[model samples]
Target: MDAKGSKARNKGVVACERVREEQHRYHEQDPQMQRVLEENYDYMVKHLDPVMSQAIEKVLLYQPDQAADFLAQYFRGTLEVKNYHYVEFQRQQYYDRKVRHLLALAMNSAVKDRPDDVRLYFADFFDARTKFY
Candidate 1:
């Protein structure tokens, strides 16, 4: 083969090797995350309302991080869908922001409240995202 062609092939091989190495590293790191996810799964199953648990389980089984985003979206949509124009306007302009801010604070409190479960929940969430992408 020409020198240029051989060099190009070598570069491709190196890139492939690098990708494989990165994959291996990720696989190695996954076990800890998996452990966390399993713990969170248990907590969710035990503590959450049945419908909420089912919804979260569906997300965990498919796309866990999406559960939180879905919750956020649902809250936003519900606020938007309210028939009261004044309430809806207040929600859209003021209440929603305060609620979201409070939700964030609540989440932070909850994270501290159950560190292990929170860790697992996040781990599972990240794992699901990584798998999806």
Candidate 2:
């Protein structure tokens, strides 16, 4: 476990540390700009890398004649798809929670031996499950 942890840390954390040291030296002339850059470094790496890396990889593979235009369209399409999936995910989560809640209520009703409550909860659960599906 220790060896694996050290190896993973060496791979990316070392690169991050080296980049920070270089940023400090290069941006020494502007302390404020350096601070801002340091603050955003992690954010850029976390959010931008996945999206930009894919775009760059495709650009390298295709070698488009107009690289800028190709990248522009690629980013637009990517964002559209991402937005769509995000919305769909939210809907799915909501339905899942509703179904789970109804099922839990039905189970509780059964435990209490409340026939009417059990029937109501089960009815609602089946209705939601069918509606969502």
Candidate 3:
């Protein structure tokens, strides 16, 4: 982790280390932001990466339901601690692509098999799976 991030995480309460400025601001349909967060989290943290935060905000503004899965998968990816600010561009791209593919598989499934509004049930599922994150 960078010096600033290290400091934030080291705080007793885990102050968020976020990036608020970046190349893009809003992309409601961006795969990166359109997560299906599996948590019962009432709100987002302050330290989300700027690029990712923009995407998530857009999703929350437009497609709030998807944010759950997007975030849960993102958390899972971070478990390995590989692709981040200093990672090679290609490696980052690969990581993003892999996660996106997984999200697609998870997100699209309930739309057809369930008898009720799949979005709600799927949202619940996402919450159950990622709430610990």
Candidate 4:
């Protein structure tokens, strides 16, 4: 990975770890904070763009076992949201970089385990992108 990709991946791992920790703490706390967290999570889920969600779903379904990898990629892709200095260009670059990274990771794993499915997965990703954009 390049410097940027490495940094992005690290950020993603940190974010996931934080989220998990926060969720655990919230569960241990009173019901109020838990309710608030649930509300916020629900709102975020409800507002997600349908096309983007579908694309992610397609990628996840392509290899269910790689869901964690995909989530890591998606998290890395959106990590710029935590940066106060993030600009539109930077956000776009991050998004593209993450998507490509995620795809390549998945493709490589598929090629290693089931080489014949690599082409099918690529075709599925291509078809999904048409709808994603």
Off-target runs (Cα >4 Å) in candidate 2 are: 1-34, 78-133
Native-to-model Cα distance after best TM-score fit, residue 51 in candidate 1, in Å: 16
User: For residues 103-124, what per-residue lDDT tens digits would candidate 4 score against the true structure?
Assistant: 5554444434443333344445
Q: After superposition, how far is residue 81 of candidate 2 from its true place, in Å?
A: 17
Task: Write the residue-wise lDDT of candidate 2 on 1-133 in tens digits.
Answer: 9999999988888899999999888777688777767755654455444555675565444543333334445544532222211222343454354333433443444344433332343344344444332
TM-score on alpha carbons, each prediction: 0.44, 0.33, 0.26, 0.22
Q: lDDT per residue, candidate 3, 39-113, as tens digits? A: 212122222233244534433333322344445444344312232223223434544543344345444454334
lDDT of each: 0.47, 0.49, 0.40, 0.48
* lDDT accuracy of residue 122 in candidate 4: 41
Highest TM-score against the true fold, candidate: 1
Better of 3 and 4 by TM-score: 3
Estimate candidate 4's alpha-carbon lDDT, on a 0 to 1 scale: 0.48
- Return the number of clashes found in candidate 4: 0
Clashes, model 1: 1
> What is the C-alpha local distance difference test score of candidate 2?
0.49
Clashing pairs in 1: 36-120
Residues 37-73 of candidate 1 have per-residue lDDT tens digits of 8876665466433434444343333332233444333
